[model samples]
Target: MEPLVEENKKLKEAMNRSEKNIQRAHRERDLVESNARDLEYQKVVLSEHLATVKEQLRSKSEQLATASTQLKDASEQLEKLQKVFEEKKVLDCVEPETAPQPDGRPPRPDIIVKRCKTAWESFKSFNRDVVVTDATHALAVVQSHYPATDLEVIGGGYAKGLSEAKTQRLEDEVEDTAKKLAGDTDLFGETNGSGEA
Candidate 1:
């Protein structure tokens, strides 16, 4: 009878060890599942972030293209204006006194005065056409191309809304984590089962 009792004690010890191993394996499985869920959630969040960044990059590329075109157009207009000024300079020079009409005598005073008046009128017209009108148009184009931006007006409301949403999400996640922890603690406490094998 004494030998039988000793064998029974050894069997009970083995059973307790097997139960402990099973419980440990269950805990390891639960941990693995939790890690898998966390990895899946992170993947989804990163994918969404990547998509948003792509959209922003596309928008910025479009804006850069438009700005480049405007700058090219403005440069072309300026080059044309420079050519006009060069032509005007050539026109402004004297015509070598008309060669005295090929008669070896001084030209008539009335004719000389008329020529001077015509040249002055031409210069006035050129100034109005090239200097005033074209300059005004170029100024307008430049102003339109680089329009002013007000950050406060553009981002105030949107930034505020985004901040509030982020804060709310953080609070909710913290609350959920706290609840999960409390539940896990309760489960562990119940499974401990009086601290005896």
Candidate 2:
């Protein structure tokens, strides 16, 4: 009986240890599952953040591409303007000397003044033409990039502002030219034999 009782006591102790180990395993499994859920949540958040960052980067890249295209267009236009300027310089160097005065005499003051006025007016016209040409080219570029419907959708204020700015610039240029030619005293006072202002 003592031996059986001792054996029974040993069995009970073994059972308690087994129960404790099972409880410990259950707790460890729950902890592992909770940690796994947390890791999943963090992964979701990081993925969302990464997506947002990628979208922003894409947007920036598109903007940069647009800016680069505009810059390239502007550079091309500048080159064209420079070429035109070079041509104008060459034309100036080769400008015909006022018709030799009849009888080899110096040209009359009136004739000289008239030629100067004509030249000045031509210069002003040329400047205006260049501006108009540049504006036209820019408009063409914009039109090429956007549809007619898109252009129509553009704000009226933007178009108005552009025209107003252009007009203002032209007026300023004319004023400057007038001021410069003002020194001639008679340049604007008389017409070049063509009877045109």
Candidate 3:
């Protein structure tokens, strides 16, 4: 009976040790699972961050491409304007002596004033000539003594002559004004004669 009791006590001790080992294993498994969950959450956050960064990079790249294209276009336009300026310079040097010589450089204020004065004088001369011719024709028609029909014919001739002279003067003035304005544009750094601001 004493041996049986000692053997039973030994069995009880072995069962307690087995139960403690099983509990330890369960605790270890739970810790491992918790760590795995934490790692998975971190991976998800990192993935989202990476996606956001990639999107930003793509947007910046597109903007850079657009800016580069605009820069290229501006450079091309500048080249074209430079070419046009060079051609205009050559033409200016070859112009007649009577015209103002801009000399491919900005004209002085005094030179601009002189050119304006010359243009005004030309206009005044043309106007004086027209006035003289009209006066002469009027005097001639008034002095002529003729039959009523002939007088009418003479008056009509005078009217036609005056009208033609006026028209011709107007046309000449318009052409001269255009030429002066074109020169003024070159002196003032404005665009071509088409009047673009």
Candidate 4:
């Protein structure tokens, strides 16, 4: 009877160890399943994002191509106009004395202003609805008014709705905020006199 009781005690101990191992295996399996579910969710989200980005990229590429073509056409028109203007500007080539010509003196400020106004009017007459052409003409006028000067242009691009512009602005603001958070402003430079954060 004593020997049988000792054998029973050993059997109980083995059973207890087996139960613990089963519980441990179940926990491991549950953990693996949870990780797999999370990975699947992430994959779905990433695939959706990729599709959206590809569509946007395609649209932007088309827009850029169109803008490039418009710029090329505008440049060609400008060149042709310049040729015609120079040809018409020259007086009679036969006699130097009788040649009616512009005085070689430098143009005054008022004269430059008048030329700019005339150019603006011509561009408007050509196509006021065409924004790229309009902007190019405006820039040309500015450059003609300030010859031999490098100018800075800002906030000029595709004609878009206010909502799209606002969305882009918000995205830019978010990007800027992220960069500010990651970087030290002191390392780059100081703030303006306006005391903005």
Clash pairs for candidate 1: none
Model 2: residues >4 Å from true position, as ranges? 100-197
TM-score of each: 0.50, 0.53, 0.47, 0.48
**lDDT tens digits by residue: candidate 2, 39-136:** 99999999999999999776544333333333333445567766766665644445445665678787544455557657755765665565445444
Off by over 4 Å in 1: 94-197
Off by over 4 Å in 4: 91-197
Q: What lDDT would each prediction earn against the true structure?
A: 0.54, 0.55, 0.52, 0.53
Q: Model 2, 8: alpha-carbon shift in Å? A: 1.7
* RMSD in order of candidates: 27.3, 16.2, 31.5, 15.7
lDDT of 1 by residue, 1-197 (tens): 99999999999999999999999999999999999999999999999999999997765444333333333333455567667767656445645343345666766444564577587666556644543343334334434654553322322222234465664454454454333322333222454554322
Kindly indicate the candidate among 2 and 4 with the higher lDDT.
2
Residue-by-residue lDDT tens digits, candidate 4, 164-190: 656455445345433332233232246
The number of clashing residue pairs in model 1 is 0
**How large an RMSD does model 1 have?**
27.3
Distance (Å) between predicted and true CA of 157, model 4? Answer: 10
lDDT-superior candidate, 2 or 3: 2
